[model samples]
Target: MPALGGKIDMVPGRMHGLRVQAQREGRYRGQCAEYCGEQHARMALEVVARPPDAFDAWLAAQAGPAAAPANAQLARGQAVFLAQRCQACHAVRGVTAGGPGATLGPDLTHVGSRRTIAAGTLPTHAATLAGWVADPQAHKAGARMPATRTLDGADLRALAAWLESLQ
Candidate 1:
């Protein structure tokens, strides 16, 4: 498919679906394609175009349980994440976070598999993820996420690494 441009006009009460196929394994970046709401500009899309086998493998991984932290640092990070109530908004299926109400935010079951985070506000990297986790409001205005100033740098790094390892 040709490159898709942002700024898609909305058709009220309509559900549109566009199907496209990727020929390679890579991350495809796009935008909302329509002005849906106030945050439309920040609404971005990241489609991971993986080969069939790789896609299946990723699917299997997502279907399975969230991996346990390999080291003490990651374990600490996970603990911090849970303690901070991050699970209240986001979800990492297979991992027992909060219940259904905790699923208010994004489904992070395969977040590490994506190319971007915060609806494409930042790249899916350790540094960016750490910053996002630290101060999401700074990056996106009127964001529901609150700043995690209580989490020190070390804990932030460990949490970021743990999130990145989700892939």
Candidate 2:
């Protein structure tokens, strides 16, 4: 593992496979130095900060399918996703993301399959993702992705709802 604010090559099974023991408080972040792709700086990194019970609930939700809503909001959310250029850096398997000029960010192919979002700062929930989308910098200063503040109220709800459904 790299030292705080220091760069170090990640060697698997040695210092690379290291795991940070979960703390009862605070958060963390890091950058990959392998030149994996573009927007490496924009790649979100996080760790959970909730207590055990809350973490358990969030974990369960991530492990399961997205809950369905009875309105066309989710469809509208999909449209918003495309129109907003989210496909530029992320990929959603079975979806039309990951187009040309979009090899920089982490693959969101199985975002719903992920247990945490923004690396680990927030639980993989619609509300949390919506918040992150609205203002990434507020949660993680110096984030490469600018805040997508155009979303508000129902728009945020619908987009988050649709994203959560992608699981």
Candidate 3:
């Protein structure tokens, strides 16, 4: 494969895959060619970019369960989540977060326990989740959910912080 922007020929069966240019300045994108499933188009691609140190911290956090803060703030954050009706499409184990809703999206039962989030687009960090929560379309265009613009400032922090606490 080409390192930067040059074209590289690839054989379907002989070569597993190849990495091309980064979509963004520091991000990359690729697709699976093998037709091994029903939804080939829905397989989707990934774009990831993060500084070395920040990526390291995110990796360490993803390797383990969420480390909740020891304060009333987290409780309030939980309240905020419930009040916002995020449970409709998401599931949080040991909580009444799921119901008779369409499973059109990924489960959030162990969101904080995952390494890369958004189907492996970015590191599963509080800030990333916060940004996603604030503006889903910003990160992924044509996102199913509409942007919940009501969340801001401390509310955003609390909600993101609480969601991250769900290990």
The candidate that wins on TM-score is 1
Ranking by TM-score: 1, 3, 2
Error of 2 at 94 (Å): 2.6
lDDT per residue (tens digit) for residues 8-107 in model 3: 3446458655455444446554454566444343434444557778779867755553344457887777778778887777755454445786265566
Highest lDDT: give the candidate number: 1
Give lDDT for model 2: 0.66
lDDT, candidate 1, 11-69, per-residue tens: 76798666666666777777665556666779877667777898898788778767788
Better of 1 and 2 by lDDT: 1
Residues 109-156, candidate 2: write the lDDT tens digits: 457556677655568889887988899877766666778987768888
Per-residue lDDT of 6 in model 1:
26
Pairs with steric clashes in candidate 2:
46-119, 46-120, 47-120
The stretch of ten residues in a row with the least summed lDDT in candidate 3 is 1-10
TM-score of 3: 0.59
Q: Model 1 TM-score? A: 0.79
